[model samples]
Target: MKLIFYGEKLSNIRKLNGLSRKELAEQLDITEQAIWQYENDSMLPRIDVLNKLGQLFNVDTKYFFTQEYLIHKVSEEKIAYRAEDRESRKKTKLEITFVNFLDYYINFFEQNLLIPQMPIMDIREKTLKMLQETNEDRNECIKKIAEFVRTELGLENNKDLMYTLEKSGIYIVEKKLGTQIDAYSTVTQDGRLYIVLGTVKKSAVRRNFDLAHELGHLLLHDDVDMDILSSADLKTIETEAHLFASAFLLPEMQFVKDFQSLTRKSNPDYYIELKRKYLVSIAAMEMRAYALGLLTYQENRYFWGQLNKKQYKSFEPLDDEIPPVRPGKVRALLKFVLDKEVMEIEEICKEVHIRPDFLSYLFNLETDFFKPYLTTQKDYFGHTEVIPIGDFRDKTSTR
Candidate 1:
């Protein structure tokens, strides 16, 4: 039996930790070239150094030696980034790597468990089919699709959007994706759809809008090749998604009925009540109303002026009143697995070749989430038994 050292694993972990080779070398008290050598398979760290590497990264020492799992590879081209500055390929790569890690962790636990079938694929198919089958133009098509989604998902009025999305099998994760990015959506090669929401500027209404926008991307732009898209192409898709989100959140029929009461259609304050009812921002509602032809173009412009005058653009009324909804599906599933003893936390750590703390960090879980589930055994014969978890030996490394 022979053990192989995988340099790619070291590189990925380093990148995920946001460490440059020079920075990592400073921590390791080694030369920068040595870190590069270790990551490039030109040199292997000694036993003590390997253990230190594991401790630094909060992974089992064998993680560096073990063959990495083959989850769906995430590329920047496949991601719909909801940001203005989409130039950071490094950041994109880091995020995608993190998502892949999440994918592997999830797949490990969900192997035998029955989960809800993801509804996005079917919805996307139906949306495309409708586009082909109907004579409706793009905006009309989007509005009809949005209405259809609302009906299918049973999102009546202001029903809890986050809960419904999770119930419909969309894996949502709230992450610190910088202030520039609002959110991003991706469908893995295995058809697992994920929407990573940014925690920045995350009010309830804003979160809802982000979710709907990403949902629009998932349904409308799943087949788009983002790499080759020009600035204009990106803008066009963004506009389309925004329109979809507005329509989806504020269903035309219901919103029009609500809008009928606002005699002062140009007054931003008049839409506050509707905002509370729909749990959408005043600006968003104004846009929706204008899109629906309920507000004249001049009325919409006046509403914006009033909105600016009130200084409600950054933080609108009811932004604090409406409690932001947190994603609970992953947390709930983890609790269930732990409560049912399907897999102990420590055991899962060993299987995944990561430390319990790192595992918790990846999922944004509490620091002691795995503490209660960890079991302690008394030492016998002055020697603790060690069980090999994964293939202890491998001839080659595969990414």
Candidate 2:
């Protein structure tokens, strides 16, 4: 029998868009029976019907005709040489699509309801230039970045900024998707952006790096038409993101001046004292010292070595004891919608563009942990009760 690719493609797109056959048929102005026939390979749609299907599903017509549909179930390596490349392209495309969708949704909500506008910062050019400038006082740079984010968003702290992002439909999930992957960010087809972190490297410093890197991708490279990063390119991107993150997290001039003043007494424990003030790793403090010319290369290397050898107390908490995972922005927004009754449970799942099963699993595993803290109930007697949903364990054992 000839392979009927369109049937599968149609079905996949329909499901991904969270549309039932009848619903899709209604949208396309076609009979529900026609959709059933098309999905079962009993009949193929005509060119007019194909065009309507493409528009309705927001997928390219070529996608239905190509063998790429069959490759979906194939082993990762056995697929086409460009499989990885194609997947990457698909992800980027989806990211842009989702971002646009979010922009629209945010606009709709603000106009129809009393929702606050989400703060958006376009730091792409600024971030790229930061990487190109040498002799840049790194600490001052970080401070400026942080101040910019704070001022733009009117946030007083990182926690507030995180809350705003979560409420604005961005989701950050912590999981080990793959080895050495660190983290990946993508906006779902329904317009929610997600940053999924690999939990293998649980160091707060590393997690900070991954978060900044993923944010860099979200802000700057989302429109770029490339998927795989070359080692050199990856390094360059990582460097830029690090600079952005550092500037954002640790403001330079303030930190430096503070460090200088704190160490002015020449106390042998000056570095240790400074680490406590900064909430940074000892290694980070050492780098800051070197950047400030407070320590020579030899001294910096020696201190780092000593740190690795556990000769001195490390500043940051141990990675194993305290992983850097946090509740993502996407979960926050979904919770808000559900709590506010702005969206029903099914609607929330549909808007976020996740399967009912997957959405339920994600909510129970991630959002349910903090549901109580985020929700409040009012009884008929005019008394308020706060329900608390505690921490959750991973439902997927392997992940």
lDDT tens digits, residue span 291-333, model 1: 7788878887888898999999998888777777777777766
Candidate 2 lDDT, 107-127, residue by residue in tens: 333333454433343343454
lDDT of all the models against the reference? 0.78, 0.49
Which pairs clash (backbone N, Cα, C closer than 3 Å) in model 1? none
The 10-residue segment of model 1 with minimum total lDDT is 390-399
Show model 2 residue runs off by greater than 4 Å: 1-116, 121-147, 150-161, 164-170, 186-194, 199-201, 220-225, 261-277, 311-325, 346-356, 362-399
Assess candidate 2 and give its lDDT: 0.49
